[model samples]
Target: MARSQAQDVIRCQYCEDEPAVFHCVPCGDELCPRCKVFHLKSKVPSGHNIVRLSEKLHPTNQVKMCVVHSYKAYEACCEDCQVPVCIACIQEVHGKHTIGKLKDLYERQKAESEHELTKMKGQYKSEIIQRIKYFKNGEREIKTSHKNIREKMKKQAQDFIDHISAILTEALDESTRDEREKLMEISQYRAEAEIFEQNLEQLIEKFETLTESSHPADLILYRKQNPDTFKRFKFPFKINLTLPSYTIGHINKTQNEHQFGKFIRGHISHLTLWDDSLQAKYLTGFERVKPSTKKVSGRSLKISETKTQKGELYHVSCRDDRSAFVSGQGPGIQLIDRSGTELDKISTDWEPAGLAVMKDGSLIYSDYDNKIIYKVSLKKQKKIFINTDYGPTGLCCTKSGDILVCMHEILFSVVKYNSSGRKIQEFETDQNGRRLFHGPWSVCENINDDICLSDFSIFNRVVVLTKSGNFRFTYDGNVLKQKLKDRFNPRSLATDSLGHILIADNVNNAIHLISQDGDFLSYILTEDDGISLPHGISVDTNDNLWMVEENACVKVYQYLS
Candidate 1:
């Protein structure tokens, strides 16, 4: 590198020389500072931005080039070789190499790069817009799905407020009664005080009049004391009623007129759905799950699907499905047509919860809440025996007519009672240490004597146990995939004659269908007429469904098949 006091370092327009002069008036040659030509004619362009060879041009962003010669002006890149090339080297090296014009090459490439950057920026903008749309739409759908739940929660809160108000109202009434008693006592004392004050005032007024009298004859006559007039001056003690504090409603465990407690006229316990011979007749069983204990879910439930409503059913040394005893709510086991229409009502003091008519025609039932398993004779009444876990809610007569029960409360427990309600053997609760939540809501003994209980309250789980309380499988309305997590609360359980377990999905407001394994089947009612606050559910031998809503009517949905 070299420097000079003149412009054009590479060449001089007038002179062809190397180092003496940066430019020359005569044959000027672009020169470095060391190569300045002495006594050179000056032809400097005043407005030119070119730097002298003796000075650095402050590291110019404009590429270095010859100042006066337009042909030698700065250019960013060479197009033909696709590399940086200067004007002096062009003719020497790139003159015959298909060299592109420099200015044209730089302009063309700069525009192309700019276009690419614009295209990429547009693509990013479109992607951001699409992503926002995706998320917002998904959020709306999820919120809509729980629309009813929000309303339900608000209603529940209001109902809770009302319940608290009712408690306060009761307390306010009690306070009023107490205040009235005290007010009555004060009223009597105040009346006596008023009488004493009136006598003293009268005596003081008489002394004042006597002191002002001039003579005895001039003295005013004493007025008569009238007790009736004084009595009218009394006023009773009265005060505003006191307000009472609010109370939250809690479970009232005490016995009251609401028909709660053990005296029980009709309380639902073990309920089950069974399919008998006909599709028209399905069975729902109810059993006295516990004899001495007073709790629901202990009663066993079983119903026999009869073929025809043609005869009053009894253990007619029963042939096939012809004469089967049924567990029912109505007093007296009413003999019914296979359709459950009453043919003749048979009276029995025992409100049987679980009922099974044996092959040789011995009728078996769990007495009034899975308390005592019994053998009933339509011709005679008798208590066969006692057996079960806290009480049995489901009962099924085996091909051998031995009773299998799905127990309540304790986990993985189900007992089998012989025809005489005697505990032939006990199946202890020894499963995978998985005990049922709360007591069992309901239970079912499938034809195989495998037990299943609709268990779990806070944990809303349903479990199937073996005959000996071994955990075979379980479902808690939750799964890795969302599809299986919908139906969580099961109220009652039953197996159709086809061996499908029908579950009363109470919280889901539908019936859940499941295989004996943990596979979830479709729901029973998904549309409008399916269910509302479904509480207890059972299937008749005909595959018809009978369900109870909180305080709503017991609806019977008949499956035409």
Candidate 2:
């Protein structure tokens, strides 16, 4: 048995011809003396803990030697230094330090390491797996977002190309039509000239024959037969036809981008893991209030009328079921009830240009004289909301608590501000860089997040824009045709529950109801309906139309269910 065991000796892993004397723990390589030297000289890291093969095989019985005193075996562990120490090291270097038996310290450390391993295996490993899944989901979401963006961009490009092609085709067709008409006129003139020339040639040949043949009797006979032809020949008048000419429109890179639309870099959010709790919180859905499908009757039934002392009221904002805030060319804005009773009054140093009721039941008004916007709390306390560079004419509060202010005068723009008064966006021009508004009189937000405003300038149109500040369309009351008695003078617009824009045409003494897309739906109130000079308009929560006339007479009507 002893001879058989000796014959079963392991060979060197590096050199199979010789027996391995040492084992490298980190590299897991068994080597002979010569191979060991070569392995140490190779790219192996320093302090590999190479030990004798016998000690490696029986590691539990192996004695540890002190690092400082290599000749002596470790007997105690110095707690202060956190290292194993030999008898000589304890007496010399660790004389005043806390020490424990090496065997006891090893047992305690082994138990602690096992506990830590168990904890990691149970908790840390599961957490790492969950984190991996979260990151994978996030990667997929990012890929999907990028793909959608690419598709949207491609669609926009194709639409723009199609639009340009259509325009070009129309222009060519028009030019061809003009060319055909002019060519037909020229052909008619040529045909008339050819007939006249033939007649002249015939007459000349006859006269030449008569003169050359010395036949006075024949010439006299021919002249007597065609006496009417002897008169002066009549020539067709020249047609002064002008050819068509075209002037190419100059479109630079900036103008082209404006017309075709350019990319707008949106806000990018930070990346975070969507855990179960986060998913439960964010993935939940809520009910949305759908817009009404009822059509406008074009005839509103007058419900009640409240006459206010404020002369020529310019604005009226419904507060709730009972009261509304009204402002005019007065020193203060008054909140009045259905019975014409004053509920409250907010006195201002200057006349308020625009007034709106916020979601929190507070009143906000714009002072054009001071170029400032003030917010009045329910308790009648006033505070400065925002300072503007231009006079603010109209203002409204959105469902999200953001304020939309119409700044008029030299700069015509609608500026959006958050509750904290931070400017979020501004719409000054259309996609073609043309001015969007001449004088923005009143502003309102639709249920679809579209902005509707009345322009009180000579244009007298209602402009609509998307939430992202993109131009949608404009309504100029041309669709009304003969129905519109006077020029469309839009002022003080409001949106109904059906997302329809109702604009007051004070000059025509009518209210024009249009869709969110700027399509003229109907004239809800007209001169025939006894709505005289309707100016300030608003829609209450109950879908009731509240309008203030030029005489400061507030009228409520049931226009929609």
What C-alpha lDDT values do all the predictions have? 0.51, 0.80
Candidate 2 lDDT over 162-203, as tens digits, reads 998999999999999988987898888999999989998997
The digit string of per-residue lDDT tens for model 1 on 280-309 reads 211221232222221112212322232332
> Largest TM-score belongs to which candidate?
2
Best by lDDT: 2
Which residue pairs in candidate 2 collide? none
- Weakest 10 consecutive residues, lDDT, candidate 1? 310-319
TM-score to native of every candidate shown: 0.36, 0.49
Residue 511's C-alpha lDDT in candidate 1?
Answer: 63
Give the C-alpha miss distance for residue 448 in model 1, angstroms: 5.2
The worst-scoring run of ten residues by lDDT in candidate 2 lies at 278-287
